[model samples]
Target: MSEILRKGDIGQAVADLQADLRRAGYAVERTAIYDNGTRDAVAALQGATGLVVDGAYGPKSRAALANFDVSRLMRESDLIAAADRLGVPLASIKAVNEVESRGRGFLADGRPVILYERHVFWKQLVAHGVDPAAYAERTAILSRQRGGYAGGAAEYVRLASAMQIHAAAAQEAASWGAFQVMGYHWKALGFADIESFVATQYRSEGDQLATFTAFVLADTTLHRALKARKWAQFARLYNGPAYAENLYDTKLARAYARFAGEESEAVA
Candidate 1:
């Protein structure tokens, strides 16, 4: 018997809905939160299949999903290309992938994993003639804090509030995808624009990996550090001054060693 899936649901079933939606080319994020994005995707899928567009994944929707072939979500060739382009070892790239993403990219609500910069959004609002003094406390709270969001759905809820002030600027204020690259870096990372960057982020992990490659390639110092296997330097430059607090450099080194050992074993 197929389980019913609806908005507000969480866990493995929600994750499955996201995965099958992606398989159906619905452009939903694989995050386990059944937020607006998931609801919209479900609606889109239902409309296409001539089912009742209620946005609920019931028995009928499950049957449809079962018929569609699951698409390749990531490619080894893309990873290899990114590594080669950055002039870094595959193990090094793998280390970053493992350390940075831990193998998850999108939230179940079909949005890329993001940490919206509320302080940045507030600044943008103020610049756009909105009064920050009115939302002063909220702005301060958003600025000082990070990572309380349960999933992409929660992040989007916060983002929607910011969007009430300035949509484009709010979008620009968030870090997106498995790489957690800032949207403000879109131009620097070779994306035609922020929207294009966001779209790519919504597409798949492959696009995120490509963007990460572009980001690494754009920063000569970071690229050099990566090629040299300077984990501390790389982590400091990539992750900011707080890298030591998280022991990001140490984790990178350990991950690199593990990946390199696996590679060596594969060759042997």
Candidate 2:
């Protein structure tokens, strides 16, 4: 009871923590050891309960579990449905999910994940009838050069400021949810508009999967590459031309193997 369990701590205490987390309907494994999954679940619980989200099982985290609810954030059925919708193996979806989101749709504070793109914001300002040159100096939120990222919930600060300048364009400029689809793709992704797309984002991870599947299905090249397991082709379409430099395709192949239970040609 005196020890604080973290990402590497192991033993009966860790196992108990896993059980309690699972009981609360978090997507955690009872592996008898504290790992990333356990830490993320703990962090989510802390965020939901207004405790400091340090991904550690401390005294406060222990106390919060006593009043926890079994409000699961996602379900197995959702994954199957998404894969079915795409006519691909569940592993394909899972591989992309893991690669893009590290298997988390929401952040520590129960907000859907987002990344504010300065370059996208720069373009968005122009689309919204604002002078990009005037706000180009606000490089953190609006700029032609793509390099300012606050990461995690902190990115919302950037988004908020951009919203003040141009609300619709600001929202369109950011990537959202587990699949990290850019808001600009709302119409083509089947959403009525950016607000509709954003609304679904705040709903649940299941909805996020829907957005991802829609994105994949909408693009013939992307869908073909994913179904064929052509990692490099899919990576280029999804992550941009610099995907190889980031080893995104390599990661996709390896991640797909982990979920698909098959060896990757790239790896083996």
Candidate 3:
């Protein structure tokens, strides 16, 4: 591994490097292949720890990762783009981001915050041609009923296990990043597949917001709900039928009001 590792490289060396970066709190996955996610994480590490922002792995990055504020993943421009894409107010977009992820994506460890639902995984695997009865014993990670939320970075543990059974299915079952956009929406969001959708999560909050915008634009009803300030409808469409029980609609409305007020004042 004396050579500098860049995108398009592969092998145990790459995986090892990813492991080293992950331990240092970078979002590089241990996929044994150097993809764009790895490159971005490397570049982030480089810029954060004062190395050149080359997006390549070499001696400097290796030593720097163990030490780390990554470059900004989200920006005001991202929110504006999302609002423009949805034909809604920027306040609306900001409100959703705040409600879904407290206004930013990623964990303190630099990994995207994921919520891998067991029931979704169960159905996804079955749909992908893997029988759940084969090991119903592992209900924690595979269940018809959802409830084992480890939350935040720990959710990746459940994801890693399910990935072993079926990579694409596993990824599609989870809600990812700032907006918690489900990977199942990958195709409609314009990605080639779930793998690509999940990779973008590792990119930045802005990337996640872009996916969310795609999702809203594709679902006309959802888009209209947000545009009309129909918080209840938007919440139900976005978060499922039981949204009222969690007051997601209320939270969204309040957050929107706060941002709208601020934006209005700025205009004045």
The TM-score between candidate 2 and the true structure equals 0.72
lDDT of 1 by residue, 210-248 (tens): 988898889999989999999999999998999999999
Worst 10 residues of 2 by lDDT: 258-267
lDDT of 2 by residue, 78-160 (tens): 76788899888877776776576545678877788999998998887788788989866677887778878988999999999
Tell how far residue 230 is off in model 2, in angstroms. 0.9
Error of 3 at 197 (Å): 0.7
Better of 2 and 3 by TM-score: 2
Query: Model 1: how large is the Cα RMSD against the reference?
Result: 11.7
Tens-place lDDT digits, model 3, residues 1-268: 8467978999999999989878878787899999988987887776666543446676446556655243435555677778887888888887887676544467877788788988998898888898987868888788989888897778999999988888888898898887888888898889998888888988887788888888889999989999999999999998888999999999999988977875676589
Clashing residue pairs found in predicted model 1: 29-110, 31-106, 31-107, 31-108, 32-108
- TM-score for each predicted model, relative to the true structure: 0.67, 0.72, 0.70
The candidate, 1 or 3, that scores higher on lDDT is: 3
Candidate 1 TM-score over all chains jointly: 0.67
Weakest lDDT window of 10 consecutive positions for candidate 1: 68-77
Preferred candidate (TM-score higher): 1 or 2? 2
**Whole-model lDDT, candidate 2?**
0.80
